[model samples]
Target: MVAALDVGGLGMDAQVSITARPEPISLDPRRTAVVVIDMQNDFGSRGGMFDGAGLDVAPIAALVQPISRVLETARRAGLFVVYTRQEHNSDLSDAGNEDSPHRIKHRRMNIGATVEAPSGIRSQILVRNTWNTAIVAELEPRQGDVVVSKHRYSAFFETSFDTILRAKRINTLIFTGATTSICVESTVRDATLPLHCT
Candidate 1:
């Protein structure tokens, strides 16, 4: 059997057992969320940003089915679902101004350049509302899933992601998606910090 999230809950106070390092933990399903980060075409699909830059995306593509299964299980357990997309304005204003690290990084990657995806759609890489930033078909957000558009690797940066989680009372987060070392890790770090506390 696939090692999906072991979520078992019933009443409002139901909790799921999780095997963690150092010690085991239990969490309420109602207060948990599955956060899917940057599973966009630009990173996982052929002829998208990663492919256009000559990077191998097969491993990223391979994750879709497993993630889909986990998502389905989460939904069945009534866990909240949230998706984060790395996107910027068409004019790149949100990416950052000249000499800024964000703009410099994007420029190094040639982000926003027009490219023809394998799907035959012409789209600018990582631009908001474009095909490149759309979640892969296999894991598209269903009704009631929150889609958070982020301009940086960390989803909480200048975005409503944290607010949405707080509003939904989501205290536990189960993350899945591409670039585990970069975007995924960044979001995790931000999520654990008490940045909002004054």
Candidate 2:
């Protein structure tokens, strides 16, 4: 009856113990959450944004059903659910802004942009915008779920996800969907709370 959860950048494992005369405690759905990563059209199924990065969407689409189920279940249980997607300025110049900090790294790394354009101005990654940065359509954002815009690979990095989680007192998180080796991995590496990744 014990489990680990991931909240923001902190990871904590909690075990529930049963006593002889235990007081049955009701679970608080308000303390739980689920984070879905990069469920957009470009990085998701069919016409994703990552196609230019030599990334494929067919595999990411497989999680559609599972992620949808998690969304529904978490909502019903009153758990705060969130999603993150990687997006950049259309001009690609803002990525290098000094104040934002990500502006520097994003400008240098250019995770979304694969190769320089033939003219040496843009990149092939800009063509689709659907593959590299777009969230899959099947698992689109809803009015209730928190949608976060991530400039870096990790959703927890330089994003408002943590702020909202704290505001809602969400402690536990379940992560599912898209780019297991990329965005998903990055999130797990940074998540500090107790979490169950399925």
Candidate 3:
């Protein structure tokens, strides 16, 4: 005869042991989406914003190849792929006083100031349509992929990210990108909110 399995919680005086089993989840590609966050030249390339500011790009650059592989695999599996880019207007009109401190600091350090990008556009770092704001070549978005531009760390803040996800009927999101503690984490936290998809 099989022994009875007590699956409920036991009190301190109880002396029973329980074994937990791992369950494998089958993912439906149609309902899943991959969110690639801020994998741009400004944060991952040499002579870019972060590098020009004396920040090491090696760590962030290391994620490129792996993320590219993931993008390829996800596309092959027919999963929706979305890329989020952080950028501001050339005239700094979109950036209010909230980012003034950072701008002032970078200006003081002679970094992140207006510079001539590879595209021949004279703009500050992460300016839209400039080379520094473009997604890295290794993981560029394909024809069917979606691209969202955001000015804040959290992609959901004043962005069409949620609307696009809902339009595609996406239920699960896999986030992959650079600077795990900042933009990536912020996006993840915001994505966890209850989405009221019509």
Candidate 4:
């Protein structure tokens, strides 16, 4: 379905129709942004959080190339690109204090435990500025792309993500990343809501 917006700015129109489930969606680069969510080492690489917990990283690892291609295409089309990292504060303050459900869940998973990354660096799982929280080398955010660090599964929750999109006058989003049923799905659902952007 084509839902064209005014998208003022001479010579900025570059619309394309992408065949998708449910219907064919029209994309106008001027009004759209591509959100790459939680494609971090802790979730997609060996010796990181998911791998340390015995979860298979193969599936997540396989996505790097495809997502890279998508990002390249988006850039060429002049679409705004945003990358999100799921991470917590180094002191664990923002991870929820004193047996909160958030902290409990993380504890169960040993979320902050130190683990040796494939790069031979020992880093705390999902902690900001650590190897585990960094986006994989293959999909690093290029210059001119925005990066946001989110503590929760949904990037939009208590984050500047929505505000950033609104400031860019973005009305359409293309989401791609790890854990389709979790972080990715959560962000996509949140994006559907109307925000009273100034």
- TM-score on alpha carbons, each prediction: 0.92, 0.64, 0.79, 0.89
RMSD in angstroms between candidate 3 and the native structure over all alpha carbons: 10.8
Q: lDDT value for candidate 3?
A: 0.75
Ranking of all predicted structures according to TM-score, beginning with the best and ending with the worst? 1, 4, 3, 2
TM-score of 4: 0.89
lDDT of 3 by residue, 42-84 (tens): 8998867988778899999999988887777677656688999
Clashes of 1: 0
Q: What is the C-alpha lDDT of each candidate?
A: 0.85, 0.60, 0.75, 0.83
Model 1, 1-198: lDDT tens digits are 114455453567766677776787677787888889999999999877888788899999999998999888888888899999999998888888888988887785678888776677788998989899999988999999999999999999999987888788788888899789999999999887986321
Candidate 2 residue-wise lDDT, 1-198, digit = tens: 112221233224433222324573333455766788877755664433445445665677777877777676666545677888777656655354565766654434344455543234434342234344545666777788888877677887778877778788766666776678878888877776444221
RMSD of each: 2.2, 9.4, 10.8, 3.9
Q: Candidate 3: misplaced stretches above 4 Å?
A: 1-23, 98-112, 118-123, 196-198
Pairwise TM-score winner, candidates 2 and 3: 3
TM-score of candidate 3 against the unseen true structure: 0.79
As a whole number from 0 to 100, the lDDT of residue 99 in candidate 1 is 89
What clash pairs does model 1 have?
A: none
The candidate with the higher TM-score, 1 or 4, is: 1
